[model samples]
Target: MKKTSLGIFTVASLAIACQSGNQAGYDASGLDSTALASITEEAYKSYVMKLSSDEFLGRKPFTKGDTLTVNYIQEQFKQLGLSPGNGDSYFQEVPLVEIDTKPVSPTLTFTGANGSLTVKHLDDFVVSSKRLQNDIKINQSELVFVGFGIVAPEFNWNDYANIDVKGKTVVAMVSDPGRYDKSLFKADTMTYYGRWDYKYEEAARQGAAGILLIHETGAASYGWNVVRTGWAGPQLAMVSDDKGASKTEFEGWISQETATKLLNLAGLPKDIQEQAKKTGFKPVPMPVTTTFALKNEFRESKTNNVIAKIEGSKRPDEVIIYTAHWDHLGIGEPVNGDSIYNGAIDNASGVAALFELAKAFKAAKVKPERTIVFIALTSEEEGLLGSEYYTQHPIYPLKKTVANLNIDAFSPLGATKDVSVVGFGQTEIEDYVIKSAAKFNRTVKGERNPTTGGFYRSDHFNFVKNGVPGLFMGSGSDFMEQDSTVINKRKAALGGRYHTVRDEVTEDWSFDGILADIKLFFDIGYTMSMEKSFPNFKPASEFKELGDKRLAK
Candidate 1:
């Protein structure tokens, strides 16, 4: 069961909140609203415009865009008087390789007692592999529907037990089939097993030649266009050790319609779906050869994590990290005439937020007790590559790294009375946020879609996995004393143009929402810096054991 941490500052009650006349209260007493009037809407608008401009080149990884973005971040850190985090250097080099593998024209040679059939790519199947080898192929192999294709002993679900897929391809349901028929599994909430990342990883572990997910828009929460566009672009993989992959050779997704046809060719009843949902279901192979011809060019390049440190007043070695990914999908296939994925909201907002906080601290009358490290990580969208590398090889050890605060895709919804923490119950940092949000009469809420794994999907997961307490929250739509129509106007902008060429800065967006969220983030950082105690995961959190293990030192 999920556990909520004790409300923050409750334990530190007397130590945290200040009296109306106390100097420690963040707000200045007797200060008029006119004092902050100088911090105008124009200032925030101007900042967003520069960060999301087309010259940033969709802020893509391993490109000229990265050159401009990293340089700007480093320069801003310098202006803030933050020293280079990596001994005399701000950059922590992250090597990566871009492998643009074109989906081969699939020759689905289906032979049966009825006749012989051939299927084409897109119309029939799409194949991809991380192998990067030129001769990536899978011919004369069989296709199988493997009941979500998951094997989790904990869930008492193993769709592929007692079966050997040594050299064959497995066609599986995309997401978790349990999503559609909840009674069959977790009931609408997708588990880790349902993710395509997990399904393909299992295929490789099973020694399969290929794996393809059947794409249904509603189930996947993405359209076929997303699959097509993502595959059509240059895909990236991190530079890793020579230890080879137990790679699935021809791996990709097929349309649900095509999957239905393939099942029909195998003389299989479509009702196999319900049977697969039940326990004790096993994978069965259909005699078929899904053929494809994949070709691609590979390029290896290096990227850097821009790191700068604001030294603490006393315990300077211990650090608090504030991070945002400076990389995006980069330049890719265009929708309409626009070719750039400027990444305006996806992260230009995050990068902008980090820099703004750095500036705020620089202007503060007092400094923090622990070092504040501003890290604009590289290749976050590319498998959390940069942050992963940093976690493995830190400028400062994980034990001394106090906490990590990550920002991504700040919605431009007008200010609200609540702030939604992406992974709310994961740590004790929730307490700190709850205490601070109360100042503005804003309540803290949990993620709207835990099934999507947004927390794991972002860079902070790397830190959390390595035992650093982390927090990520955003301004929400619900308002305490605001109009209902006002909330809809903001939510209307949610799905429109996300991750598209359409994601751009405009006058229509009110930065008030972003401004409010950023202010809260600054307060969180300030509170963590001043408090004598270190925040850890609450006992109720799954991650609390990690905090216990570390803090026991």
Candidate 2:
């Protein structure tokens, strides 16, 4: 027998208590308060510990770790007595291609009037080929400086205007023009146009043979070392039906220093970035050409997105999804004698929260009116691939999904007086977050740095892109009973470990904050589950029209 807030109760007794409401009490939203006890720190810690342990090998997809990770999640769901979410199965197969692209030479050389300058691999530049082919080559493709390489007509911005990049290698700056100029685009806040992935997509759309984004620490929100570590190994992509023919032959990054050398070699001004930031900046065709080739070793493999659900008793067609990616960096380049990028805080924490949420929902005395779907997604580290695939081929109709609540990385710092909502004020779904936070005397706030484009970096953005309102919450900054120095040091320490082999669980971690967040998440999801109204995207939101179209369908 399990001991809940209502004292001793077997599984049978708990179900009866749910129905009779004798020992268990209900909140203002009619959610069973007793169920909240199920989201304990012990359970969360256990899941995080087990999942992030060395045996999991960082939980990367297409590895033995992937098989073990998915099996653990599925077995947990089964033990919780939840039905499979994907109609008779707990797993949704996501096909992916692992492409290991290696350059033919140790250095990529640029030939110009000034002479030839070579950039070393993994030091000055890093490149990858998304195309599903054994061999790829770019033979002295003309080099053109294409500013930001964005094409957003709505924002009255077109970097590609009056320029033809056909068969040429376009050298663009990472991030958008708005990053430098507050008057342009979204100002300090980064839109999708600012993402490197978007830059590559735009370049491919313009028929560019290759695209190299100049990496600036401030604009890219990360150092060159981070980029080198991420792109040095095999890259994963969705196994496209067209074999990625629509993409550019190669996409890469060149360090800011290397970019400067190339610009100086071409006799271009060092103030090129300043000129590009201004409106109506045109592309400059540099008198330089480079030959690049990649020998790609690729293999097609499948991974699973572990999904399970608690079906609604009344309106079963409608759903409220809770998602978190289960995959991480896997075994990567050795750092400090450690090879596994465990990703304990990056996502294992989120998956643990997912499990706790499922358990909490099951503990409730009353069943939700809307189906509650728990998806332990995969490959979020490699460009939010799992969620993107799910949105593209939804098991439930897009029109029927109420909203997406996503958890990516949870803070290990202690409890705070507020909760951070990424991409704040985009939808009415935030109202639920606000309401839930108020119960615990915590205020709602936006992320500390909106310019990093944190919202677009997560899996929830995929749901928002597909017309479903989505919400992503983060642990608040204002730690209770902790001084600013201690907090800053703690935060900085964790920041240093992010995405590295050192992302393992530390002994000083506190789950008090996480437990509080879990309750708030449960409250929001529970409220949405019982509500008949759908949350709509705000008019200023880029996804507004998509939301309207979804509901119209």
Candidate 3:
């Protein structure tokens, strides 16, 4: 792919200062209207178009696309007059290992009392191994059905409590019991235990040889195609001291059809899912066994988190962060003769938003009282590896970091009457979000579908996990110019193209929506930067105690 330079654009070159104070027809809450106006549709479109173009090769890390992408962002920060965020360097090195796993035999056969069944790879299932070893094999391992595969002491639930899963293959359901039984867990508000990654971690902790998640569309919040494509290539993970030997031997997913057949073969009831939802449900040892083997090819390399900052005039040590991931799926399985997964919305648009926000801060009439940091993270799609690395090894002190505002995959469907804050009531940052939205006559709301675990699915969750108050906003459903039916059709169409080659910018997209969102984000970050006190997690939030401890001094 040929790389092209979009040229440098400085704060002075924006010429936004000339049209200050309500000239752009937006009366924000006394913020520098000049800075707000600087975030223009032209600039946003240019950045998105350039970053998501075929020339960028989907911006995957450890590839030629990565070199071009990071260099481009560094150049932009330099032109925008922002200083390097990490001790005179715009890049923070993140060591990682990429593993490409291939099955020794493309079929997994399960033998039970009824009969034997064989499933084809990618069609009925998809699997991968995290271990650094070149070969991994599980021979005729006993299969145990562990409901949800979660062990939450606070919830008084343990799926692996009575049974010894050592050296056995455990099959679990995605999501949690609360998703089906309102009486258990958070009741549709998916907890961390509901996430697939958590399930794999718990299985490995319990000494399971292998784990296969039964994929149901609603339970996984995505289709089989997502699993088939997402797990098809090289998987990236942060470099481990033990080289991932501690993780499960292998983790994979089986389609609902395959799972049903497996259950029937074991003479288990068809209503097993309903039974699994009840409390005190025990792990069912299927009278079946299967073999799993994979050959892995891995390499070690270092990717980058592009960081830039604008120092505060007064309290330079205190900081506020704005983050957006820049990496995508790169060239992958071809769809409609196209292999490049140009993640225009998933998140070249987000990186574009990061630059626009940086431009706003730089164009402010007065320097902020707290430093503002912009991070273009890498490898968020590959299980948030970039963020995992950053939070573990922070460039700034975690305690001094006031707040994190994250942008990911902004809608291009024009303006709406409301804006959504993921995990709405968790932190006082919601107060800031509400006040900011009010300035534009927009209402604030929680995520429309909490069962999808949207809160823990992004880069900001890493910050939240470390006791930082993180804000993640979404474009609300109340479209200003369209009815719900019309908007649903458009949204559904967009969802179909998500994480695929067709996610590139199209003719139907409008900048009015994302531009409004960028404005709301600017207000929140700007206000927090000027505040004296740190934001706190709400008492009901799980991270409240962590937040309290961090701010105790």
Which tens-of-lDDT digit does each residue in 416-440 have in candidate 2?
Answer: 8889999986887877776666556
Q: Could you tell me the lDDT of residue 272 within candidate 1?
A: 77
**Cα lDDT for residue 145, model 3?**
95
Per-residue lDDT over 223-310 for candidate 1, one digit per residue giving the tens place of the 0 to 100 score: 7766765665676677656412556765788787777777777777778766776777888777655555678667788889999988
TM-score of each: 0.89, 0.94, 0.94
Rank by lDDT (best first): 3, 2, 1
lDDT tens string, model 3, 1-553? 1011101111221232233334443332355777889999999999999999999998999999999999999999999899999998999999999999999998999999889989999999999988999999889999999989999999999988889999999999999888888888988889999999999999999999999999999988899988998998899987888989899999999999999999899889999867888899889999999988899999999999999999988999999999999999999989879999999999999999999999998887776899999999999999988888999999999899999999999998768989988887789888777766756667777899899888899999999999998988978978897567766766776768778899888876879989999988998898788779999899989999989988985
List the RMSD of every prediction in angstroms: 3.5, 6.5, 7.3
| Runs with alpha carbons beyond 4 Å of true place in candidate 1 | 1-15, 19-21, 28-41, 106-126, 176-191, 486-494, 540-542
Ranking by TM-score: 3, 2, 1
RMSD of 2: 6.5
The segments of candidate 2 whose C-alpha lies over 4 angstroms from its true place after superposition are 1-24, 27-32
The better candidate by TM-score, 1 or 3, is 3
**Candidate 3 — which pairs collide?**
none
In model 2, state the lDDT of residue 173: 88
Measured with C-alpha atoms, the lDDT of residue 188 in candidate 1 is 55
- Count the clashes in each prediction: 4, 1, 0
